[model samples]
Target: MTALFDVILPVFLVVGFGYLVCWRRWLTEVAVDGVMRFAQNFALPVLLFGAIARLDLGANYNPLLLLAFYSGALLSFALGTGLSFYWLRRPIEDAIAIGFVCLFSNSLLLGVPITERAYGPEAMLGNFTIISVHSPLLYTFGITAMEFARARGQNLSVGGVALRALSGVLHTPLVIGILGGFAMNLLTQAGLVMPEGFWAAVRMMSSAALPAALFGLGGVLYRYRPEGEARAIAMCCCISLLLHPAVTFGLGRIFALNLAEMRSAVVTAAMPPGVNAYLFAALYGVAKRVSASAVLVATGLSMLTVWFWLAALP
Candidate 1:
């Protein structure tokens, strides 16, 4: 317990401090936005780029890890939807919303900072592997699910949905980081390395990512405090905080992922539902209240679960 505290406490301290600052109005919303954007858009990308660039890409990359991680997510989604319809006596639309919340995680904003803090910079490569594809895949699943949940007989244009998903993939910072780092690593493998001076500046930006990100997480929690249906909220908590990570750990073991890879898969799976889960629900015009309630529930529960996963990591 002492050892675990030594590892995970400082990160939460930064998070709590950020929460306090925001609660006290020590920083304006605009200033908070600036700090979050700096960390999210710039610092995170740079850190991911550097970390990925230095990796032995061929050996380090593992597609099966993604499979294992998503398998758990899909299971959790199914469980949430099942619980909604059968037990909660909710509509199918509400079930869809519950499923969506259980599936997506706040990997970038919360997961990255927490994983980096607990496991150090190297574990970020594993975290990056998940973050890179997180949005694009979830976006596709989210859109399709929402479409089905609402009305159930509408036809979405395949080409249009594909285009939108592709566009999102192209614009995400995680994708950019992975691609850029892979390019750099490719060049290094061919005997050309990045200039030391250039890398030092990248490292400087990278250094700000964890602290700024933790602070930004606090700000985000303040920004989105969703409220509605306690039963739906409790369902989200069970799926996200308990079932998701448990299943992820099982899958990781079955896939024979290394310790670092296992830790990455389980830790990320344990994070709270993405804030966009609420946005996705809002956009689809289905289960908005259920989704909002789930977000708040998952966020509150994750403060403790995050520590459990970090400490339990192999």
Candidate 2:
């Protein structure tokens, strides 16, 4: 009860406030777009850069931890894709888009803040470890899959498709931030020290990342109402909120992860699909409605599901 009130509700309250303001027409779409642009393109990338630049890669990058969390993610993707195609009769393209909803978790906005509130700042090393590669790995995989799905009967070369996927992943702002951080870390390790003002500016921007992102995310969710595709939405919510974390938890135990690692892996796996799910679907013009609705519905469902996972985690 205490954790539910103290740790979880505050985060959702911010999100809810965003939704409320947008629903009431107090905040216009243009304003929301600007806010999201600033958060995603600037603040959040700065946050990732600072965190990764400071991280001790050797100590924090645990293979078992990565395996446990990502194994669950891949399993959910495969299961979601297979079920959507075989049972739901969705097109191959739509099925891959839906599978992406299952694959990509909101590790940065929701996962980081909630984990920080529930545990502490230090416990976030594992969370950062997962996030550093989250976008690159999943986006590459999702884009490649979608490209292949679209390329069938279109005379597209496999090599060309692969290159396009790689190019898209490389150009993402988040991935750019991560690669920059790695470069900085390597430079600092070699005795190159940056000025204090640079770090001060990084801190300033980093502080605004989550609050702005969450509020922007709320307004974005408001735009994606649950109109139709009830069954597909339900399946996505189940896979994202329940199955992903369940697999991570089981694998965490199997891998004998420590308490912090267990919490990070399970909680991150439990996050709803990020807005990128919608963006991916929109990019390819497939399953746009289902992807958008799944993000909104699964986000609402995650409040209760995350509380349960928190209680269940040791």
Candidate 3:
């Protein structure tokens, strides 16, 4: 019980408080979006950067764990794509979107924060291990798949599409944070000490990242409404909330992940679909309806499912 209160209660309380206030009109949608952006673009990067720059990351490195994590993610992606194409009879573009909806975990906004709150901040190192590759790999695959779908009727250059996809990877703030932090870590390893004041400033912003993210998450839920085909939304939610985590856990065991890695991987897998998926869908003009509905449904229900998984974790 003490562990429950200490580990899990704080996370949900902040999230519930965020929802309550948003529902009560204490925070506007614009305000929430601003806070989310502030956290994602600036605070999260600083926090992650400081983490890598200061920590002795080599002590916990696990290449096998990464292999296991990716195996699970790829399996989920393939399953979702197959189901979307065959079961739902969606177009190629929509099927890729469905696969991404399953594969792209909300690692930053909800996964890292919740894992930190539940297990402790060090758990986030494992998360960083996962997120470092998550975006670049999955986004590239999704974009390339979408490009191929778009090629059916147009004179689309595959190399050009691949270039655009890679550009997206470069432009992502989280990826920049990982790369920058890695460079700093290398410098630290080479005997360059990070300044006390600079670390402090970054820490200050980093401290607010979790709370602001939780608030923004709740606000997003409050404002979100499901539309379009209910069947598609339901299928995507199942893949996001259930199948992904199950496969992650199974693969973790098979790949012999340590306790921390297993927990981190499974928890991240269980998080709702990334909110950015809707943006991609909207931009590409495919699966927008299903993506929007999936985020809302998976996020809302994850309030319960997340806790269940945390409690179930050994």
Candidate 4:
């Protein structure tokens, strides 16, 4: 219990601080945007590269664990989308957005830091590996989900869709950083060595990534207020916090993951919805309300859900 409190309180404190700053108008949307841009484009990439460069990828690679995690995510995505479509009676696009909110989590922002704090820095390698496997699916299938929402009755363009899909991969700093790190790791394995100063610089830059990300998330929460969309947002949060994690936990057990790994997987599964869903919805101008509501709802409720899972775990 003490460990759990130690882990959870800092998160809420940061979030609360963000909420207060926003409420006081001390952190404007413009400031939030600038912070997000820096975190996404610069700091996060350095963090990713540094993480991957230092990983002992050859020995630690667990194909079965990766398969189980990805499979669980895919199943969760399908189940979330199908159930939302059936229950909500909404358009495919809106359903897709809600479903996405149910499955895709703020793994990079919240998952990394929390897991690192709970399990230590070594856990980050497993976390990043899971993220790398999910990134392609997120880029391809995730964009398709949004496009489905936005296209409505219009005829789909294969060429345009392909270009857009590829663009998603090329534009993501996370993906770029992962690839760059993998390349460097390969070179290092073959006997390449960097000067001490260069390594120190990379370490310095990487250290800033987590705090910046958490603060950016807080700033975003300040800007996001559910307002009139409370009911819909609540529904989305219920699915994201309760149903999604429950299903993932069951799957993890069925796959016979060890207790520690199972707990980690559950925490990862219970993460709040990704903010990228809102960004994509805004970019495509489709189901923006649902996307925004999901972000607000999932983030607001995740504190409780995370605590519950942590307590429930051994």
lDDT of each: 0.78, 0.95, 0.79, 0.73
Best-fitting candidate, scored by TM-score: 2
TM-score of each: 0.85, 0.98, 0.90, 0.89
Q: Output the lDDT of residue 79, model 2.
A: 94
> Over the stretch 153-268, how does candidate 1's per-residue lDDT look in tens digits?
66757666666656765676756776787788889899996679999998898889878987876775676566757888887888888898898898888889998899888888
Task: Give the alpha carbon lDDT tens digit for every residue of 295-314 in model 4.
Answer: 87788778778889777766
- lDDT tens per residue, model 2, 1-314: 98889998999999998899899999999999999999999999999999999999999899999999999999999999999999999999999999999999999999999999999999899999999999999999999998898788898888999899999999989999999999999999999999999999999999999999999999999999987998999999999999999999999999999999999999999999999999999999999999999999999989999999999998
Error of 3 at 307 (Å): 3.0
Model 1 root-mean-square deviation: 2.9
Tell how far residue 145 is off in model 1, in angstroms: 3.4
Rank by TM-score, highest first: 2, 3, 4, 1
- The RMSD of every model to the true structure, in order and in angstroms, is 2.9, 0.9, 2.3, 2.5
Per-residue lDDT for 1-314 in model 3, tens only? Answer: 55457665676677777778789999887888897788778877787777766656776568876777677677777888898899999988888887888878787777887888788877777887777677778888888888777778788788988998889878888778877888998998888986799888988988887788777776766665787788878877887788778877887888878889988888898888878777778778888878878887888788777877787788
Identify the runs in model 1 with alpha carbons over 4 angstroms from their true place.
82-97, 147-156, 282-293
Worst 10 contiguous positions by lDDT, candidate 3: 1-10
